[model samples]
Structures are given as C-alpha cells and as structure tokens.
Target chain A: MSANKSILVCRCAERGLVDTDGIAGGESVLVIPDLCRAVADGDPMLGGAFSEVHACHPRAVQSLFRFAGHPLPDTTQVIDCRCDGAGHAALGTMEDKPPAWYPVIDYDRCSSCGQCLEFCLFGVYEKAPDGRIRVVNPDQCKNNCPACARICPEAAIIFPKSVEVPINGAEIDDEAAVRANIRVNVDEILGDDVYAALRARKQKRKALLNRKKIERALEERRKCSGGDQ
Target chain B: MKMEKTGVHGIPSTLQERDSLRLRVETYADQQGLVPPLSMEELRDHALELAPSSVSVDYVMVLLNNAVWRETVASIPYERRLLLLPQCLRDFKNCPAEMDEFGLLCEECGRCNIGELQSLAEDLGYVVLVAEGSTVVTRLLDGGKVDAVIGVSCLNALEKSFPHMADGAIPGLAIPLNAGGCIDTTTDVEHVRNAIRLRSDASWVNQVDTARIREMVEGWFSAIEIDSMDTRTEQIAYEWVCGEGKRWRPYLLACTYDALSGADGIFPEKVRRLALAVECFHKASLIHDDIEDDDEVRYNAPTLHCQYGIPVALNAGDFLVGEGYRLIASVPSRTADLMRIAVENHRMLCVGQGEELRGLVDTPPFTAAQLIEIFRRKTAPAFGAALRLGALAAGGDDRLDAALRRFSESLGIAYQIHDDLEEYRSGEEHDLRASILLALANDQRPLEWYAPDSPNLDHVFREMMVEEKAAQLLEHYKNEAIRALNPLASAPLKSLLRRTTSKMLTPAGGRA
Candidate 1:
C-alpha cells in the first residue's frame, strides 16, 4: 500500500471502528482491521462506538513530531498534551523558537558543482534562468538539512549540525550564534559593501605577515648553519 | 701489485654502493688541486669540498679498511675478498706458541678449538685470521673471500660489528668475555650454528611488485594487435586517459562490492563491468575537478592537467566520461535503465556545484527546507544511484530496489549532514563554507532584512550548540532506512544494506 493509504488504515485501526463501507452514525465508514477484531469478538456495539469516534474526527491525524514521539519542547503559551499526572509536565506550553536549518559549505575548497540543485526534491533552488546553477531561493528547503556540502568533491558546502540558544538569563542573539564566526565577522566588517576597501586592506595585511614569516624562516636557517660550524 | 676497483652499472645490485666507492676515490681530490673527475656539477662541487687532504699510505689503508667492514656488514659477495698479505698470515697467524717456547708450537691435540678452527679454515677454502678492528674485516669482505660472515666478538668486536651489523641481513652472534676484548678468545662453537641459520633463513632476492592497473592496461595493449600505423596514436590516447593513478576509486568500488557480496563471491562479468564503469566515472570527474579546482598534485603525482596540459586533460576526462557511458550502456537492459539514473545524479552534482558557487557570492538566511532540498538533489542522488545500481546488479526484487533506494537516500542525506557539521567543526580557517551554516542558522530573511547580533550576547552562542536539532533529523532518516531494509528476504543482503546505511548515521568519534 502507498504511504498515505497506510496512514489512513492506521488511523482507522486506532479508532477501534467497524470499518464498514457505509454511513455509520452520520459518517462514511469502511472496512478496517480493528473493526474486524471488534466484530470477531461479537462486540457489535463496541465496533459501532468505534465508528462514531472515527465520524467525529474524520481528518484527525498525528503530526510528524507526534508520530515520532518527539513533540516540540513545551513553553509558557502552547499546551503540552503528552504530560503525566505529576505536576512536573502536567501544565506546559509549546515553546516558540524560529524555524531552524543548517547549511553545509566549505568556501575554501568548494569547486562549485551544481549537484545539490539538481538533486533537491523541493523547489529549494533557483538556478539562474540564465543557466547558472546557484540556489537563489533556500527558503523552500526541507527538514533544515545541509546536504549540499557532502557531495561536493572539494568540500565547498557548509551546513549546521545543531543550533542551541543559551537559555541563561542574559539576552543573546541566538541567530548570530548559529552562524559561523568568520561569516559573522565578515558581515560585520564588510557590512553590505560588496566591493569594500577592507578587502584590499586585508590582502595587504596578509602580504605583510607573510613577508615577516619568510624573513624569520630565513634567519632560523642561517642560525642552524652557523651553529653547526 | 695493486688491483684497481672498477664500478660498473650492469652487475652491481644498487647504485648506492657504486656511489660510495666513487666518493671514497674522490675524497682526496683536493690534494691534487684539480677538478674532480666526476661530471655532475653537484657531485663535483661536493667532492671538491668534502675530499680529504691526501690519498697517502694511511689514506689507502683507511679505504681498504672501510671496504672490508662494508663487505662484512653489507654481505655482498664481491671479488677481492682478502687484502691481507701472505707474510702477515705466514708469521703468527695459524701456529700457536707454547708459554715456554719462543718459536711457534702446534700440538694437535684434536680438542676442536681455535686451532681446529684455523686448520679447518684452510681445508674448507676459507680464511682464518686474528684481525684488529673493522679494517681487516672490510678488506676481507671487499676482497671477495666470503659471501657471508660469522663474527665472534667480545665487547670490542660487538661494538665494532654493531655499526654495520645492525642493518645487515647476515647473522653475527656474540660470545662474551675475552681478555683485552680480543676477537680470537671470544669466538665460540655456537657462532658457527648461528651463521648457518642466518644464511638459510635470509633470501637476497629483491621483493618489489610493480604491477598496477596501468600495467594491466599496458599488457592488454601489448596483446591487442594495434596496427603499427596507428600504434603511436593508440599509445597517446591510452596514456591520456590512464595517466598515473592508483585507481583508488575503482579499488574502493571493487572492494566494497566484494564486501557487500560476502567476500570473494564472484558477481557476473556484467555487474563487474558496471562497478568498473562507476569507478571510471568517478575518476573522470576527478580529472575534470582537478582542472576546475586548479590543483597541482593528486596522490603525490602531477595531476593530469599538470602533466598533460589542461586542454588535453580536459579532453581526456571527457573521453573517459564518454567511455563510462559506453560501459554502463553495455550492461543488461534493466541494469542500463538503473545506470541511466546516474545521469540524473550527475545533473544533481552539477546543481550542487552551482549552489556552492552562488552561496559564496550572495549572503542570505536560508531555511532548513531549502538546505535539505539541496542535500536530497545533490548528495543523495549520487549515493542513491550507486546503491540502486548495486541492487539492480544483484537482480533484486522490486521490494529490494524500493527498500535500497529509500535506505540509500536517507543514509545519503544523513551522511551529507554529518559532513557539513564536520566542515565547520574543523575550524573556521580550514573551511570557508562555514558561512553557509551560519547563514542558515542566523539569517531568517533576505540579507537586508536581518538585524545584526549585538556583541554582549553569549546566550545566542549556546543556542547554536543544540545537538537535538541535528540528532533528531539524523534519527528520523536513519529509522526510515532501517525500516526499508526489514522486509528483504535475504538476511545477508539485508544485513549488508543495513550496515551501509548505519555507517552514515554513526556518531562522530574520529577526526579526519
């Protein structure tokens, strides 16, 4: 059976209904496994009662999080339905956090293979209609995964594995914390300047540092040779 | 009369020994105040500076001494085995003197001791003499008197012998305790036994196998009748593609498939061809990748682009890719259909490449959905295609194909996610792509819309370490892969498939 059909059947079975193909208590009914079990036990009334429950919530289905038994953490606002009799989780609300995603890229080594765009199942990539294979739209991503990075032969893709917001009393930019430090620095330093003078300055600084390093290495070599004599 | 040492290339085992002898000859070149006979500029320069002051009597003696020790230590059977004069042996070498007698005394008591050793040496056509230091040993070995050696030494002999003996193949056993640390008294009966064992145990043959995939290709070339008129062209074409490679990807394919099929079980030739075809595809990509990446070396050898020049290398890569298509197409009809899926994977690969390039140019917040979609298309398809090919090659049922496809895709995604995490974890300096993760996690909108984080916030950093976000995603995908594998009838294939999938979701323990 198709995955959707399986879900439908599972729902029918869980309601303990006699899945008869007809209107039952003002609801459409169909044959289901639990209904058969109830009928076999000669509990026609129980089966009928099952059909009634199905009628009341015909579209009721468990969320992916609920199905996986990893419902989102509770906060002050949203009610937590999976709590016990104890006062601990007895009253809880679903936490409000921004939708999270990780992107995997290796800027130093990326040789720009457009495999991620072609492979993506969602409309997650907007390859330039001009034939550039770049992802113009990542808002349509699924499951917050960064799969583009792994298949990159030169490892030019980056993705986040985890994102945690420090729950301490101090305020923190949880979003900035999730981004890479270098990227954060670059954004801060370069700040919307696509062609910043900072680029030349940084290159100059690197060149100066490299010269100093070379001079130091040469001096070291001279010392070793002199010491040998 | 003196015999001059002649170094020849043809008969000697290694170039090193001949060079050493040549160095000894040139060590005293400075005394002549003339340019050294050596033609090579570097060697000539070295000889001028390093040559000794003179090639006098003492120097010649030292040279002979060095030769003897080298012979004993190196154990190469040479012609000039003995440098000692007959007079040196004639005087006090073989005969033993009594304590009271001034003249030599030889009482043959048949005790089978050093006296016997000396007499037996003459009978056996070997040399028996009391020598002082390595000078004598070197002279003997260099003189070609012995192909192997047995040295019995006191502390002095042991120390003297150890410098060369430590690295030599021949065995030399030590017998301790002798007055004045002489070699004669320390020589023991057991030393003979050790020498016999050493000779029997050691093999002097060179053990090096130069066989490689390139060699196999060469052999095939030789077997095939390439028209002599086209021979040069064929050689060029063949060398262009094969180049110098260990063919590591092909090796991995062969090994992994063998492992998947339960070790050493042969698959049909068609399947084998498919496996090889995949490897060829991987290599062809690498060849092209090297050019695009501007890399100089691959596997410690010059990259194809570097060696053959970029344009030719590019053509060679294209040619190999063309060959890959031919190879895959040669497989059975159904397998060919599955292999065609590889074309889709190739498309995904290209898309991924473009995404990466674009990401560097533009900085914006990406949603989780967008990133996952990229992963599915880019990373998952290639890996998924590989697994599907393997399944199809095995003639797996529909259930098996569906199961493997789902398992491979999920596993591929998890593997990609783990890889992304690793890139950043390696440190910011190591990977430039860490920006992607940062953008995804922080930028929830277009670049202009997002507000920068204030410096005072440490709590924000803590939120970035939430392992559950990735762990949950990983577990969900891994569960799907496992669930897919459960229905397979072949326990072994199921186990193999499951194992391959599990490897993707494994916890990070080791660093690359």
Candidate 2:
C-alpha cells in the first residue's frame, strides 16, 4: 500500500520521542521499529506503504522519508507524538548496536570510482578483496563532518542526519536547490590536499572569518571615502 | 518493489560528485541547446540523463541553469544585485537579531553563519535581506530594487519561492538547507561565499574612486596662474581663483565627464579648460554678489569690494566674467554650446539679483514662492551649466542632458535653502539676502512687527513654524534631485550624482 493509504507509527525503540502502546492497531495503522533509522538504513518497510505518520514532527518525519528516496505524498497527514501525554515509547526489544553516524552508499549512484576511499583520512572505507570499496569502519567516521561525502564524484554518499539536503538524502528538485548546493572541488582551493584541507577548513573558517570584516571595512573605507586624502 | 535504498534522492551528496555533476551538466546543457529559464520540465529530462542516476533532476538543473545564467549574473554590477538569505539560517537558540516588516535586522554577532555571509555580500555592494519566504523578494523585484538574487531556503519553503523565480525567470541561484526544521538548518557556507564573489569583466565596477577623483579635480585648480598675473586686476582675479571655496562646481564637471568617458576613466587634459571656465563664472558671480550685498566677509576674508573698493572690485569681477568666456571659447569641442550655457546662466543670475534689489515691498517682506523662484533662478543655473558642460563633453544623449538639467535644478534650490538655514538662525535679523525664513516670517507677522526691534520676533518666528517650513523645502528638493537621477541609465554617472547629493544635503537632515 502506498504511504497515503494507511497510518504509520514509529515506536522509536531508543529515544522514545513517541509511544505506540495506546495507538489503535488495525489494518489501517502500520508500526515501524524507528523511522529515522529505517530511512537511514534503507529499510523496505519505509517504502510507499503507509497513509499517515505518527512521528516526532511532521517536517522532521517528512525529511526522514526524503532521505530514504521516497518522499511522503502531500495527501498524507503526519501526527506529532513527541509532546502532550505521549509517554516514552517502549519497543519491547533489546537496543541494537549503537546508532551509526557514518556515510551510507547509494549503490545505484556509485560508479565504483573509489574517490571516497582515497578521500577518507580515517579508515571509513577500505578496498575489499573483490577490488571493490566498502565501508570497513562506519563507527570511525567523524561526527557532523560530511567533508568526505561532499567530495564524492557521484553524490552517492548519504549522511542521514546532516543539515543540508542531498547530503541528508533529500532529492534536489529546483534551481534554488541546485544553486544552494554545490559539490566543491577541493583541488581548486587546497591543491588536491584533501586531508590537510579538511583539517584546515575548521581552523581557517574561524581564522579567516575573523579578518574578513576588518579587511572589507578597510577596503570599503578607501573606496567610499575616495582614498586617504 | 525494487530493493530499498537509502540516500539516493538526487542532489549531490559529496563536493566531488557535485563538482563533476556541474561539469557534466554544463556540457549537457550546451549539447542540448538548453537555454537558461529552461522550465522545470526541460531541466528534469536533461538532469536525469546528464546527472548520475543516483542524483536527482533538480541537482543537475542547478548546473544547467547556472551554466546559462552564470555569465549574466556575474555581469550584473554588485550594486544592482540583491542577496536574499532566509532568517531560519540563524541559530534561533542564540540569535539576538530582531525582525522588522522587511526582514531580520542582523546584529552581526558571529553566532551564526548569516553574519559572515551578510558581511561578505554587503562588502561587495549587494543589498542583503535575511528573511523568511518570498514576500520581500517579490516586493524588491517588482520595485526594481535589484536585478538578481542569491537566495537560500529549505526545500519546503523553496517550493513556494522557486515559482516566483521561475515565473519571472528572474536571474537567481538558490541553495536549500540540508535538513528541514526551521531551526538549526545548515548549508555549505563556502558555496555561498563563492556565489557572492562572482563578477564579470565589466571594467567600470572597479573604477571611479571618489576620493581619487576629488583629489585630481583639486589638483587642477592648484597648479596655475593666468599665464601672467601682470596687472593688479590680473593678480586679484588669480588670487580669487585660489580662494578657500570648496571647488564643488569644477568637481561636479570633472566627475560627470569621468563617469561618461571610456572605461579606462582617464582625465583628459582638455577638461581642465572647461572646469576652469566653470570656476571663473562662479567666482565672478560671487565677486559681484559681494558688491551688491555690501558683504564684509567671504571665505573668511574681507569681501573683494571691502578690500579693493567697488570701482576696482567691479572691474576685477568683469575681468573674471571675460576669463570665463575665454576659457570656454578655447576648449576645442562644444565651444558654442558651452558659451551659450555660460551666457544664459549669467543672464538668469542677473535677473534673480535684479528682483532682490527691487525689494519685497509686498504683504510679507517676500512671498515664499517668489523667494523660491529667486533661489532657483540665482543658484540653479550655475550648477546646471557646470553639469551640462561636463555632459556635453562626454557626448551625452538628450536623455542624459534632460536628467542633468532636472538634477541640477533640484540640487541648486536645495543647496541654496541649506545655506540660508545655516546663515539665518530663527528669530535673527534678516540680512540683505533673500531668506526663506524672512518670507515665512512675513507670511505670519503683523505689519507693525516689521519694526526693526519688534519684541515678538522670536515668538512670531516660532508660531509661524518658519524653521520647519524651510527645512521641509530643503528635504523636498533633495528628494527631487534624487528622483531626477532615476531616469538616467549610466550607472557611474548616477552613482556620482547620488554621492554628490549625499555630500551636500545629508547635513540638510535639518533637525533645525
């Protein structure tokens, strides 16, 4: 069934932002282990199989589907269960492996280019014996640093929790989206030194940002004031 | 159903992917003959084929649209472009900015990326707006306040705003926030920085440094005496030429010429003659005005008539007038036109002074309309001639000439009022000059109040609202001057005129 045809609930097994205990369970209601993780992991249950979503927030849940390559139809209503008397969700199962915050490869888009493997400073990816690149240490990936993903040649890497779309797994839909999102060519700015460049970006953003205003003001004063005279 | 896959929603995930996709999209757009403003459908088809299957049509469409518009957007002067940023980009938890009807008033606190981006765009001359939604965008575009936009928003919001861009085909580039929740949204800040820095090969954007131009014009007057300061009259004329006046008339002439000249912005030698002629006409009028008004002080020195007596001062003034004609007649091009301007302006000025000398034997010492007419006739012609001569040298078109005429008229009247307000404080005695306040006072005062020592002078002036009326006229004329420049197409000349207005009338903020 398409997502719009049934009600969906995420009994978030861990964070418990929502609880499914009192929800009416019927053919019209569909329950999920966790929408965020299900979307992140490419779980088949997230397919167009529900009409309504009982999630933390409509916008957050809607984005979760976008990351999973299946956007929620406009016809579906997302019911927020994060507040009110919605008690802590109990999934009645053991907590699985700690939530992964690593890059997920979109195999359909990956051209086996090995760009990610070469770009990773940490052992996030490795050359499999079959001569294919694989995520060897997903846990080792840096948190909130999607630098490696930005350097992807085919935009095939997904950081499900990232702040920007495409990287966060939302589809690019319009010119505005395209203009806002640019895959930067690291070679152009830092001379192909991805490792050093990535490391320096953090520090430089601070250092360079400090001087930008001062430099611009001096330049503007000269231009506007018509020079020292 | 096909095997489930996470993360292949179509936008570029990695910078490398994005970079490569952009190049491919450019090539594809060219091959497909896809012009900019290729509607969403056209972009979709090409995007699907050109971008990686994993990437969405919208991702590739950005490349395609930018490929076509990149040159156009870059070519627009930064002064004409608008930078539209969403307020949600702020760190709502820590942001201290306030929102007005127009948009967020950024505090530049550095708590969020908006501050850095705003500073960068503003430095390049963009009008920046940090707001939510497309309302401000529509208003700005409709009002012709901007030519292009660099906008950032979330996908959900983009859905609403993108239609405006696509429909108008208004040249713009958009960046969507990575995840959607109005709070704590993120984007590639570096990407934004690059977009703001984009420029075209227009050489003039970097030209016309105001101070450099001011210094150059000042240098021209400082460098010479009239071949021979042989006679006493010659010496006085040269001395008056180098007096402590601001040299604004000549500066206006040179700046106008520069604005309309070649992109290299060279100050041609011939312009010196034309500028000096302008100064001559100005000095000659000041000399004669001092004789008529019997002024004792000018440029912080004794009036020419006071120092040299009316006989010699009158002769010296005639000599400067002759010199003005001589200088204009010497310039090779537009000699006839320049001479006509000088003579016509000189005539209007004499007529205005003639009215002043005849006396305001009317109901109020002088009617406000009659005073304004006197100011317009006396002050506006000199400024008009200066600007017109400069423009004529540039081979300016009829529209430019008309604009210059309108601009100079308002500028002249406004400037005269400013001077009057400065010289005549409220409740002060009216000098021999035609003062707006005197006219205003006459409008309210009883005939007996005209007595020299009328005790209620200050009270009558206050009750009449003389100061406020004069200030309003000054402000009204200043705005009129600005409005006159709107019809002008030359960006440099418009900018120069605007800067000139600000320099003169900004103090007319006559809180007086």
Chain B TM-score list for all models: 0.46, 0.65
CA-lDDT, candidates in order: 0.41, 0.68
Candidate 1 per-residue lDDT, tens place, A151-175, comes to 3333334322111111111122453
- CAPRI verdict on model 2? incorrect
| Residues forming the 10-long window of minimal summed lDDT in candidate 1 chain B | B80-89
Top candidate on DockQ is 2
Tens-digit lDDT track for model 1 on B142-199?
2112334444433333334433332221222233222221112322344333332332
Q: How many residue pairs clash in each candidate?
A: 65, 21
Worst 10 residues of 2 chain B by lDDT: B1-10
lDDT of 2 at A132: 59
Score candidate 1 by DockQ: 0.00
Weakest lDDT window of 10 consecutive positions for candidate 1 chain A: A55-64
DockQ-based class of model 1: incorrect
TM-score of 1: 0.34
Best by TM-score: 2
Residue B368, model 1: Cα distance from true site in angstroms: 3.2
